[model samples]
Target: MAAIRLLSFLDAGPLAYFTPLGAMALFGAAHFSGYVKPYAFPLLALFISDLVLSFTVFAEFRTGLLYSGWYWTYLAFALMTVAGKLMLKEVTISRLIAATITATLIHWLVSDIGACAVENKLTFAFYLNRLVTAIPYELNFLGGTAFFSAIMFGIFELAQRKYASLKPAR
Candidate 1:
């Protein structure tokens, strides 16, 4: 009991520190609340973070302060979120691995398409370069999501064991 409590506390940090991880907690919470909308939390998190990130980190990449390209990029996020919600259903190693791949691929394709559209040029080389450059970052994002998702899911499972009422029905 004491060990589970300690792990739960530790899980809180990872659960909140990153946007994706935080949404995983909300996903679990929503499951506890009742019907799992699945994509709700992840979609919300991705949309908000993409908006903020485009305006801040990659703001200079485009002309305007807020890149209109973000909307397209977010479409991919929504795709992956829906995939995660619908296909995964339960948090497991296999599902997390699959989600990581799906998220990376979706982001790559959408972002590259946005790149071509925004530049007003449809070029294969441009998309190829974008895909190559995006690989490292996408890998990192996937790794982080898997790591934190596992932590959050584990912690939640532990909590449910102790407090049965908190468990989301199968």
Candidate 2:
């Protein structure tokens, strides 16, 4: 979990000298532009991680090269990003908190629904069972998203403060 948090921070931060520009290029601009691009990076990361694990690391647990559940999961991710972009114009603390919670909830519900669908024709009790099973995973997602959102918003605000001239005047 610590490693995942670290990777998310490194992946989300926009430091000029320390961070990779490619990742920033993908997620950072959306912070200012209200663009729906940050969704791509997380989705890409999730897909690639799953793909690699399925092929190499966790081959036994892996179901296939592309899990059918991934489509819904990615769609949820995209919607979460779009929610962040449309709902958050600036990186305020409240907005970040709300966005993180929203993202976590969206991922939880959508992914679990996908899980139920994949399993096929589950009853209400089964869906309730799936919802209960998702608690830990949702908590982890909420925690990770909050951690990373804080890092990203903090760094962006720091940069905006330090290099005020670079920011657009409004």
For TM-score, the strongest prediction is 2
Which sections of candidate 1 miss by over 4 Å?
1-37, 47-65
Candidate 2 per-residue lDDT over residues 1-170, each given as its tens digit? 22342354344343211222222222343554544456556665666655754555446545668655678777777777777666576656776677677767777788788888888956788888998987865666666566566666677778878998856578
Cα lDDT tens digits for candidate 1, 8-41: 3344444222235323533443353333444455
C-alpha lDDT of all candidate models, in order: 0.57, 0.60
- The runs of at least 3 residues in candidate 2 whose Cα sits more than 4 Å from the true structure, single-residue gaps closed, are 1-36, 61-64, 165-169
C-alpha-based local distance difference test score of model 1:
0.57
TM per candidate: 0.68, 0.75
Among all candidates shown, the one with the greatest lDDT: 2
lDDT for 7 in candidate 2 is 50
* Residue 102, model 1: Cα distance from true site in angstroms: 1.8
| Clashes found in each candidate (C-alpha, N, C closer than 3 A) | 0, 0
